[model samples]
Target: MKTITKTSLVAAAGMAAALVAGGAVAQTAGIATVQPDAAILSAKAFDAANQQIATTYKTQLDQAASQQTALNTQLRTLLDTNKDGQVSQAELQAAQAPNSAIGNQIRAAQQKAEPQIESLQRPATLAQAYAIEQISQKYDAALRAVVNAKKISIVLTPNAIQYAPPATDVTRDVIAEIDRSTPTVTITPPANWQPQQDTVQLLQQYRQIVAANAQRQAQAAPGAGAAAAPATTGKAPQGR
Candidate 1:
């Protein structure tokens, strides 16, 4: 995905909405920007798979969440020597001295929990990868069709530019094309099927976007612990 960073840009509509909001740029010649990953995320097939996976893997998902919380707590207790609520990489490194007892305990705990976490997450992970792969198979053709139809001579990612007019962004157009081409994707992967390495990375970015959206929604909900501020600090994970 990174290899296509400039040539093949990506963004979901939710995130792209913010990026595409700026002064209008009037161009006589064809020029545009598209977010490929976001287009895929916004695809109908991807949304359906997300919902299906959440329901089908409810047990594993719940268990994984609980396990992650416990692991974070353990890591904090072991490495947060200064008693900060958060643990830092420097603290972790310092705790893992050549003959440190804390290092041995941390290593042992992580080793034991690592496989358990992986096992619990495997189903949903593979399911997501499969869905992404199914949709992404049509990306090239969809992009090409959009470029030809829109007469876009030069395309760039929103990330590559400081600002651009909303009209200059063809992300939504591309997403529509993707949805039309691959309306629905499957969560069920074939037996012994393995995801391509790129799919796995894309899956991770997808999860990050989902998590960020969830957090944003939670903060915006009434009676929440804290008021949700505008999300300007965190940028969506770039395609890898």
Candidate 2:
């Protein structure tokens, strides 16, 4: 039997084709994104923007730390939680009620502050966002560019390939396209979309409590530190 070849096509004004060169049991077609991980674009710019956001909310974060201490202290006072060194479920519920209220307040505050932070960080964020959008668009363009330039019908990720005639992967061409477009492009989260200072403050406070507990635990049980590694993770844990 003759092996049939296939091709890949992207909708972003690009075209490509695949050539078959080996005998095979079957052929398959599927769709996959040939794009850079959004999380990897212009790391320095994104990191800077993230650091600024933290700096902007530093004061609030400190306030949150204080409040968390007071709340947990309040919990300690209640039921000793029976002095067992852990709050009773009932006592825990009681203890958390006020914290929950505080959380609501913090959320409200964050809602208030998000806009301001958004304003201050707009230029940097826009630059990053634009860069990513370009990545998505250009990766496809590059694929098409290479395919059209080479006159192939399709291209695939290196992994998708099996035994076949060697052809230019075109991934390099696609990457170049992404670099050209993504770096120059820009995106802004919204001039009005600031994260709330109040919420940030609350988050900071909660974080402080968390840190204090972590430190205490580290002191109490040093081994836990290796596994419970806590970091202010995620300037873009959600995405790049």
Candidate 3:
């Protein structure tokens, strides 16, 4: 997975703005700046959600880990039938044979673990994206309310500006409004739910671009060529 950076979040915010506003530019007459880093804000939200989710699933995760450990022990014992502390390759092969009862038990244990493993493999990006989406749904209206109350026609992110007076920044106000409106959000989404199509596509493109750039840099790096033969002097009669 590509690392999610502040740069990418800023880019995502810009894209989000374009989509939300239909590419309309805010009027310059009464513009107010908001220095909210979408990435940072999203990260904060994700952290909160992650903590809640972790707490909620702690028992289940623990149980799954314990079950896995027990299964491993059982399989090892089954293979080491001679009680010599180590199983030979032949012993392992025999234990894994199709008709072996131990083999069937091991397979059943693995099958039971599949769902737990899949649950644990939920993508962090997906969770973060969902958290951001929920935050927007809950707080964007409050932000707009602040804008309206302040008679600000335009709200620009920090990325769009060179500099702004501290007084003109409403990021704190926006955050305060969000906190007042929704202190906590749902972290666990419905089973099998997927992120929005556009979000998925955007992330996929971002990952591909990052991967290509990395590959290009690797190829252009010094000493990227195959190892060369050790240099030898014409006089090679000296013994080591």
The candidate that achieves the highest lDDT relative to the unseen native structure? 1
lDDT of 2 by residue, 1-240 (tens): 000001000111111111112222121232222323321232233333334434544454444444444443443444343565543456545433765653344345445544444443334333334333434444556556645555565545545655433333333344455445444433344454443333233223322433444456556873332222112221211231
CA lDDT of each prediction against the hidden true structure:
0.64, 0.36, 0.51
**Which residue pairs show collisions in model 1?**
9-35, 9-36, 10-35, 10-36, 10-37, 11-35, 11-38, 12-38
Arrange candidates by lDDT, descending. Answer: 1, 3, 2
Model 2 RMSD in Å is 15.5
Compare the candidates by TM-score and give the number of the best one.
Answer: 1
- Give lDDT tens digits, candidate 1, residues 72-161: 568568776676555566766676669878777777776777567667767776776888888888887898888888777888888898
Misplaced by over 4 Å in model 3 are 1-29, 35-47, 59-119, 123-128, 197-240
Clashing pairs in 3: none
Q: Following a full C-alpha superposition, what root-mean-square deviation does model 3 have from the true structure?
A: 18.5
Q: What is candidate 3's lDDT per residue for 1-104, written digit by digit as tens?
A: 22333333333432322112122223335776663433225334534655554455555545544654455556566666677666566666766677988666
In candidate 1, stretches whose alpha carbon ends up further than 4 angstroms from where it belongs are: 1-28, 80-99, 157-166, 210-240
Off by over 4 Å in 2: 1-33, 36-99, 133-140, 149-151, 156-170, 177-240
User: In model 1, what is the error at residue 125, expressed in angstroms?
Assistant: 0.2
Query: Is candidate 2 or 3 superior in TM-score?
Result: 3
Of candidate 2, the 10-residue stretch with the lowest lDDT total is 1-10
